[model samples]
Target: MPDPFDPSPDSGDRFTFGLWTVGNPGADPFGPRTRPRIPPTEIVAGLAKAGAWGVNLHDNDLVPFDASPTERDLLVKEFQQALADHGLVVPMATTNLFSHPVFRDGAFTASDAAVRAFAVRKAMKGIELGVELGASTVVFWGGREGVETDAARDCRDGLGWYRECLDFLCGWVKDQGWDLKFALEAKPNEPRGDIYLATTGHMLHFIETLEHPEMCGVNPEVAHENMPGLSMVHAVGQAMEAGKLFHIDLNAQRIGRYDQDLRFGSEDLKGAFFLVRMLEGTCGHPAYDGPRHFDAHAYRTEDVDGVWDFAAGCMRSYKILVARAAAFDADPEVQEILEHNHADPDGIGPILAGFNASNLAALEELVLDPDSLATRGHRYERLDQLAMEHLMGARS
Candidate 1:
């Protein structure tokens, strides 16, 4: 048998990593930098060697925040050359809105008008860089766009300011005629007490109110959703259903903890399995065709080699789970249970489809066995157990 975990270049997994993710210097809140930073060119080469299809970045990840124009041009040129030499693409890009001290309070939602203006300008530059590098998606993670205390500012004002910024950026993209879309990322709370639009569901609704709603979407992260104990699978499903799943961040985290950013499939095997099933369309929905970006970091204890190991592990784990989900869905018992559960003997599909006059009359005339329906078990226990068995390699 062939090696299932092979990170072969021809593999269909369009896995990607951010320059910041692999180049993280093992620094955290308590400790100083443990490893030296790797250059963007070297990071690209590493990712390509490990079988990654593309790389992602924050503007500052490649060019320093205060670099002169000449310096910025040099850095970008070098990085682009590295990408060409290594056969990699830049799929997504974002701005570092949370790292600088000027964004201490917030970026787009900052109380200071000047601060908000500066944030928008910085985002414009980030968008230009993304377009220059041929990225089709730009993600916005409002890491500090919230408050520790509700007394800071009215959330209504914050939301208005947020909407203004996104609307302005959407208009700017339209003027430039770049084939780019904005993806808003959500986080419950970490750097701040509470972040506005704190979940994928919130982002979805917010996008609808945008000036160019069609060009906006949500980039839901596994760790961000899992931090709040939300189901990542459902969150992605909602985005997919709404035709807004433009990108995704695949990482693992322990529920109710700080953003762990663990390797994919490390902590929650079952969740990851079903997530793969959904993304691969093993659950009967169309598969999502977007960059499977891993916005995660290696353990604080890992060195340079371990960082590469972590990157490779993420891609391999995703591929392994893909195979497992396919096998689980193909199992005879699993299909039978699903078919039986979905059996609509009363022909209610069209009646529930809409409230037409004839459909309503048919619905009113339909009879349901209330007592028997309430007692009919879904056999989900057995189905869930089988899922676990497949995930655990206990079943073929």
Candidate 2:
């Protein structure tokens, strides 16, 4: 019989990693790089060997930021050969608008018109690269699109500039007839004092205001959401509910800290279990069918072997969480509690379904005992304890 705890991943799992993630050199703001850089080709080979379905990247992750046209082509050709040789694929791509000094102020929201134009132009090239690599989604992480103070630029102008940039890019993609979509990643702060569209919910609402709302979605990172002491599961659920969860970044982070980007399911085990349940729809709902991309890196204290270990651990943790979540949802006790909590014995659902004279009348005529309702315990404590047991392998 197959081991229930087996952690081996396969292509069918839809697991992916970013070149920048696995290839990260372990550099932090307080120290120099501890690990040597791993070339893009080598990264691809390693990921395939690790049983990853696909890889992702930023424009600068493969080609140099200052490389000439000929150099860029050669680099891309070599990377493509490596991917083909290893049976790996590119699922997503992004731009590095933050790294360059040109975006010191901001990219799309830059006060300098030339800087904004250059940012858009660079995004166009990044989009072309992504489509060429067969990526259906391009993520935009506006790392520097914020201000240290309100005096830097008017918030209204910044929003208008951002809108214009996205509108232009959407039109460009449509004109080229490329099968691509944009996933905006949000961060409360880090590279900047405060970032625009600071959370997944904010991104969802912002998407609706875009000229090509349907062509835009959000890429929620676990670490990014947790940095602000928010619930990653709720953020993701909102995105999924709105049908805007185009892509996701699986990693861990401690609350009230920098973006740690630790291994998946490392810090918030309970949160991770719920997140897996939501994504896999183990609790009875449609699952999110998208690449489970790990946008994380190894610790600075590790060597090359440790890096690979970190990679494997991320996938292994996710698989384990998935199994646990399934077990939790399938538990008979859990099922009973959920059914009881969700029981609409009074049949108030149909009446509350819409707003109309008849429905309003039905709702108005409804008789209920508030004291009885308040006195009835939901048994959430028991349900939560059951979940923990499942997650900890205490119950199966």
Clashing pairs in 2: none
- Please tell me which predicted candidate would have the highest lDDT against the true structure: 1
List residue ranges in candidate 1 displaced over 4 A: none
Model 2 clashes, total count: 0
lDDT of 1 by residue, 227-313 (tens): 989999999999999999989999999999999989998988888998999999987889999988999999888899999999999
Task: Write candidate 2's Cα lDDT for 209-327 as tens digits.
Answer: 99999999999999999999999999999999988999999999999999999999899899999999999999998899999999999999998889899998898898888889998
- Worst lDDT run of 10 residues, candidate 1, spans 4-13
**In order, what lDDT does every prediction score?**
0.93, 0.92
Deviation (Å) of 309 in candidate 2: 0.4
TM-scores for candidates 1 onward, in order: 0.98, 0.98
